[model samples]
Target: MISTQLLFGQLLLGLINGSFYALMSLGLAVIFGMINVVNFAHGAQYMLGAFAAWLLLHYAGIGFWPALILVPALVGLIGMAIERTMLKRLYKVDHLYGLLLTFGLALIIEGGFTHVYGSSGQQYPVPAALAGGWNLGFMFLPIYRAFVVAASLMLCLGTWLVIEKTRLGAYLRAATENPALVQAFGVNVPVLMMLTYGGGVALAGLAGVLAAPIYQVNPLMGSNLVIIVFAVVVIGGLGSIMGAIVSGYVLGLCEGFAKVFYPEASNIVVFVIMAIVLLVRPSGLFGKGD
Candidate 1:
């Protein structure tokens, strides 16, 4: 029989993993939905965020707290530059072109980092304030892990609210559906689209900051995780924010429970579920029907 403590520990770990998945896939959803970009470079951007944090710390003596705030903004600006310089030209063409462009960027970024840093990983220390854990009766809960879950949940909720309940969101949706009409109203649709892409890239950077302490900071880290994140995005619906958030957690829980029940299937459980979801409901659980 499985121990309750073991199950709870596994579940907690699953929740942590889910948090990352949700955050990463949420960025993918926003970019794809708002700008119609597949963003194959999202993983690379995530790696860049972590690397930026590491660089700021080791070189400039900046710490985690400041990096938490600065890295996203810095990376977001880089993304905005890319959108303005390159992505703008592809919007009117086939999506495959955008995908190809992003995928190429991902390869270049990853390769550049690999050449500089090699394939080995660097460790990001846990912040001093969140360096410990609480020992519950059942299991020890790490404070940083708990904070990660809470922060990610709040961010996801906040993003959903802003996208669904505000005038800015309405404008975004309207612009998506009819950019020419919005442009005619003096909305500057091009700038809006660029900012939206920047926002999406910022989300990925934030996730990287959150993940640096938990995972190794390496050139290939994003490349390793992005496939799973992409699966999460696909299972959740391509552009559905809620779908990404909910599917991420559900799949995490599924993987956790699978580990306890059938260790052999833990890795494949998520992919299996993704396949089933795709087969049953291609639009995803929270996505709108065509």
Candidate 2:
């Protein structure tokens, strides 16, 4: 039987993992909902973000704060380049083709990283500023983990607000519904689409940088988590930002509980929930019917 402390510890880890899952899925939703691409290469883009931060820190002595700011920008720029050069070509084609193209792109990215960085992983130490712990009556909480949780929450909330409330967000939502109509108002539909895609990719990259200190910086890291993220996205209902965030955390906690009572189930619990959600709501918890 697992001790209470261990259970809480696992729960904390689950929440941390969930936070990233939510962030990534939310980004995916934003991109797909507005830009109409499946973004199979999101995982690779995330890995690139972490790698970028690591390189900046190791070679240029950039610290966590700077890395946190700069890495996303770099990743976003790369995303824009990809969208402009490759993804834009598939806008009018069947989205399945876009998915296939991105899958191939993901493979190319992972393969390139593995060839250059090797199969071995690299470490990203938590900054001195965040290297500490807080004592709770039941268990000690790592300061860095707390920071991560807080940061993730704030970021998610900010994204939600932007999408639900601001003028730019209004334009984004309008564009998602009918780009041609929005463009008739003289709004540049293509540019907005590219920007949204870039922003979504940047979010993935930011998550990667945040995760590096907790998990090793490796080529396959994104691929490994991405499948599960898809499960989260499906369960939460694609194109529903709020649903993605809430479901990600709920499923993460569920998985954490499973680890205690039934270790074997921990691995598949998310999938089970996903399957159930699909059965009950074909459009997902947050998706709209065609």
RMSD of each: 0.9, 1.1
Provide the overall lDDT of each model, using Cα atoms, as 2-decimal numbers.
Answer: 0.92, 0.90
Clashing pairs in 2: none
Weakest 10 consecutive residues of candidate 1 by summed lDDT: 281-290
Count of steric clashes across candidates, in order: 0, 0
Candidate 1 error regions (>4 Å): none
Candidate 1 lDDT over 172-192, as tens digits, reads: 888889999999998999999
Candidate 2 has a TM-score of 0.98
lDDT of 2 at 114: 98
lDDT of 2 by residue, 109-202 (tens): 9999999999788999998999999989788899999998899889988998998899889999999888889999999989998999999999
| TM-score per candidate, chains pooled | 0.98, 0.98
lDDT of 2: 0.90
